[model samples]
Target: MASSEESFLARRIDAEAFPLAVVDVLALAAVLTIGVINHNGVEYLSTNTVGWLLTLVPFLVGWAVAGPLVGAYSAGAAESAKAAVPLAVRAWIPGSIIGFALRASPLFSGGFQWTFGVVVLLTGGVSLAVFRWLFFKLRG
Candidate 1:
């Protein structure tokens, strides 16, 4: 059995995962925005705000939904990079799929491209893995 102090400390550490999720979303948003600019030019962002959101929101929603489902927010994920990085990458696979599905849907503006999906999978996975690894290193 755990003592109260130990349990409290564990809870404190676990609570930090929430911020990881937020950062994951932010990191992916930046990556997605950069991707948009790379293909459509920077002016596209300013002139087509709705189009940008249409591009952005689905991925964010996908990550938000998939992270918890994949145990990305569990206490183990917050403990170290060895744990978090794989979880982050595993979470990204389904998250990207969901995002691609949402983007291909008629409600959104973009259609799914295999190349785009591959790029997002790779970039998002790398970004999440790097960030989660760095986050644990820094937290220590």
Candidate 2:
């Protein structure tokens, strides 16, 4: 890439992309873990870590990929609650839909769980919005 483009990519990814991702990943994990612990106990989390990871990691990677493509975290996007929250919601829905589909696929050993999809949609959507809100608050 050209020097100017490279710098833009570097700055945006480092400052915005990574931070949004970290926030999103943690939000999903925290909510998911809490439910699992309540229902299955803490030991279940440790024992089924691989399974949990398989369920969780895809959303992070998915957001990392789609967030940029969809302009979820772009320079032109407003960094305010009013603007940021909607953009984040728009960015997350498609990826969440795709993730749900994949989780439902027979190829997945755990099989389809509609409740899981709903939880992810609700938790991930709200979390991404919160990230955008926080991102702007931090910037100000």
Q: Can you write out model 2's per-residue Cα lDDT over 6-123, one digit (the tens) per residue?
A: 7655534434344565566676677656766776788987898887677665666666666665666665454456755776788788877766666667745545577877777888
Residue-level lDDT tens digits of model 1 in 1-140 = 99997765554346668878877887798889999999899999999988887899988889877887777887888777898889889989999999999989997878998988999999999888887777777888
Which residues of candidate 1, in runs, are more than 4 Å off? 1-14
lDDT of each: 0.85, 0.67
Residue 103 in model 1: lDDT: 89
Given candidate 2, what's the lDDT at residue 67? 67
